[model samples]
Target: MSAEKITAEKRTEFGKGAARRIRREHKIPAVVYGHGAEPLHVILPGHATMMALKNHGYNALLELSLDGETHLALTKQVQIDPIKRVIEHVDFVAVVRGEKVTVEVPIIVVGEAKPGTLVVTEASSIQLEAEATHVPEQIEVSVEGAVAGTLITAADLPLPQDVSLLVDPATLIVNVTEQVSAAALEADLEQAEVEAGIEKDAPETEAAADSE
Candidate 1:
C-alpha cells in the first residue's frame, strides 16, 4: 500500500469549544495511540483526510508529520456530524512493519447463484490477521452456478499468502436458499394463523355468550 502523506499539528486545547474552533478552521481533531504508547492529539486537514479515507477506508496508511517527525499510522475510527456529515474527530493507531493486526474485511459475493435460488449471507465481514499495511479492504467469494443447500464456510475462502483467517473454519458465511412462491407464502401464513388460534370466519365468542 502506498503511504498518504498528511501534515499534522499538535493540539494544545481540549473540550467541545476547542474542537469546534478546530473545525471552524477546516481542521479535524485526531488522536494517535497504539503500541502501548501515550496518545498524541493533533489536528489534520479536513478535506485531505476525508479524501484519503474515502479511497483507503480505516486501514489507510497515513504518513503523519508532527513536530518535524513522520510516523506511520492507521486510521482506527472517525466520528462525523449527524446532519452536516462533516468529520468531527479521528483516531489513529501507530504500527510497525511485519506487525500482525486483526481487522474486519468486507465480503463480496461474485456472480449469481443458480437461476431459481437466492443467496443469503450470514456474515458480511470476516475477521483476519494480516500485516497492518497489507490488510485487505474486501474479499470476494464466487457463487457462480451455486444451487440450493450450497454453504460457503470460512474455511472455503481463499486468502493471500500473508493473510490468515481468525474466525472458526466451520462458521458459515453464505448459504443458498430456495425461493418460495407467493402461493406457498400465503399458505404458510394461513397455517401460522391457525396455529395461533385465529380464523377469518370466527365470531365474537364473548358477545354470543352474553346474548345466549
Candidate 2:
C-alpha cells in the first residue's frame, strides 16, 4: 500500500468565496491535521485526489509535496456536492512511517457459493489496524463451493502481513442460507391472502368489500 504522490499547494485565503475560487480552478481546499501539530490549510489537485481515493477507497494513503517538503497523510473525510457530485473539501491526518492506524476496509466476497444457496454478506466492512504505509486496500473472502448454513465471521478473514483485526472475532461477516424457490414463494403468497380474507378480483363480478 504505497502512498500515491500528489503535489499540493498552500492555501492563504478563507471563506466560502475562497473555497469556490479554489474549486473553479479545479483544485480542492483541504486541511492536514494530526500528530499534535497545527492544522495546515492546503489545496490539493482535484482530479488526482479524486482518482486516488476512487482507486484505493477512503483509506488512501498520500504523499503530498508542499512547499519543497513532503508530508505523509491519510484521508480522513471528504465532502462532495449533493447535486454536482464533485468533491468540495477533504480532511487529512498527518502520519509517520510504521505508525499503526485504525481504518475500515471493505470486505470483498469473491467466488460463488454452492448452487441453491444464497450468500449474504452481513458486514460490508471490517475494522483493523495496520501500518500507515502498508494498509490493505480491501479484504477478500472466498466463498467458492460453500453450502447452506455456512457462516463466516470476522476471525475467518485472511489478513496481510503487519495487519491486525480490531473488531470482535465473533462478528458475523457472511451468511449462506437456503434460497426459496419461486413456486414456494407464490404458494406462500396465496396462503397469506387466504388467511387475511382477501380474494383475487373476478372479471365483471368484482366489488369493493369490507368497506363498501
Candidate 3:
C-alpha cells in the first residue's frame, strides 16, 4: 500500500490540558520514534489522519511533512475514544525503503465452506516479515468447499515470494466444524435448565399435585 502524505505541526505543549486544546483546533497529537532517533511529538490534522488510516487500513505507512523536511513512518499504535470513536493518540516508527519490518496483517477468509459445516476463525491476524514499502494489506485464506474437520494453520497460508511468516508454523488459524442445528441447540438448553433445577411448567405441575 502507498503512504499517505500528511503535514504535521511540531507540538510544544504536553499533558491532558494541552491535548484538549489541540483537539479543539481540529488536530490530534502524535509521536514518531524509532531507529535510535529522538521521539518527535507533533500535531496532525484530525480528519486527514483518520481518513488516511481508515482508507489504507491498519499498519499503514505515512509520508510526513514537518517544517522543511520529509520523513517516512509506519503506524505502530492508535488510541481512539471508546464512545466518540475519535482518534486520541497515534504512535509511529521511522522507517526507510527496503527495510524488512515485522507487522501484523489482518486475515481475510474467502469462499464458503461445504454445506453443513461452519467456518470458525481462531485468529484474526497473522504476523509477517516483509519490505517496509511492500507490506501486504492483508492475508487471505480460502475455505472453498472445505469439509468438516478441515483445519488451516499458519504454515498453510500463502504469501508473496518476498514475504515470510513470523509466527509458529503450527499455530491454528481456521477450522471447519459441523454446524449445530436448531433442534440440537434447544435440546442442549433444555438439558442445561434441568440441571440447574429450572423445570418448564413447574408451577402447573405443583398445582396438579396439590389437587391430587
Q: In every candidate, how many clashes are there?
A: 0, 0, 0
How far residue 166's Cα lies from its native spot in candidate 1, in Å, is: 1.1
Where does candidate 1 stray beyond 4 Å? 201-212
Candidate 3's C-alpha runs over 4 A off are 186-203
Worst 10 residues of 1 by lDDT: 199-208
Q: Write the per-residue lDDT of candidate 1 for residues 98-136, one digit (tens) a residue.
A: 789888788988989888798999898999999987888
**Candidate 2 lDDT for residue 71:** 97
Q: Is candidate 1 or candidate 2 better by TM-score?
A: 1
Candidate 3 has a TM-score of 0.89
TM-score for each of the candidates: 0.90, 0.89, 0.89
Q: Write the candidate numbers in order of decreasing lDDT.
A: 2, 3, 1
- RMSD per prediction, one decimal? 3.4, 3.2, 2.4
Q: Please name the candidate that would achieve the greatest TM-score relative to the true structure.
A: 1
Model 2, 1-212: lDDT tens digits are 98999999999999999999999999999999999999999999999999999988879999999999999999889999999999999999999998999998999999999999999999999999999998888999999999999999999999998899998999999999999999999999999999999988765534545345
Better-scoring candidate (lDDT), 1 or 2: 2
